[model samples]
Each structure stands twice: as structure tokens, then as C-alpha cells.
Target: MLYRKKRYRINDYVFIGDNCHIGNNAFISSSVKIWNNKRIENNDKITQCNL
Candidate 1:
């Protein structure tokens, strides 16, 4: 998902999946809650399910 200067209220959940690429100029509001349900795996680099 992409947005331009978007505002979010409190208790917002942002989920980024594996290999997910967040474009530039992405504004994630401070009030938003990033749960990150997907766990990152343990690897030499990063094996987590989510980026």
C-alpha cells in the first residue's frame, strides 16, 4: 500500500510481509501500531517471515 502524507489515528496496525518493499516518502503515523504479526526468521542475514 502507498500513501502521500496520510494521517492515522491511534491503535492502527501496520503489517509488512516478507520481501515487502516500502516505497520512499512513506508516512507512517506515530499513533499507528506496527504489530508485525509475521516473525522474522533467524538466518545469516534475515530469515524473518516479514521484512
Candidate 2:
């Protein structure tokens, strides 16, 4: 059996690419541009992306 992961959108301007892992109860601020395969653990606040 293939393993399918669950996905979710942060907000209107925030973009979460494929394979992005956002832990439970994670807090992401506005305008955060997270690239592909990024893992954000719980209680994390993302405001911007350097890449």
C-alpha cells in the first residue's frame, strides 16, 4: 500500500508546496513562503523565507 500524507493551507498568501510537513498546533504568520519538502514543527512561527 502506498502512503499518502495529509495536506493543509496556511492562509491566502502563504504557500505550502508538496511534501511540506507542518506539525500540529503550529503557528505560521502571514506572507510565509515555504519551499517544497519543508518541515515545520509544532509551536513554530514562520514570517518569511530566505530562499
lDDT for each residue of candidate 2 in 1-51, tens digit (9 for 90 to 100): 997554433666677788988976666766777788889987666767532
* C-alpha TM-score for every candidate: 0.27, 0.66
Cα lDDT tens digits, model 1, 1-51, are 985662322224544444533333344443333343433232213223223
- How does candidate 2 fare on TM-score? 0.66
Candidate 1: RMSD to truth: 12.6
Taking every candidate in turn, the Cα RMSD to the unseen true structure, in Å, is: 12.6, 4.3
- Each prediction's whole-model lDDT (CA): 0.36, 0.69
| Deviation of model 2 at 45, angstroms | 1.1
On TM-score, the candidate that comes out on top is: 2
Error of 1 at 12 (Å): 3.9
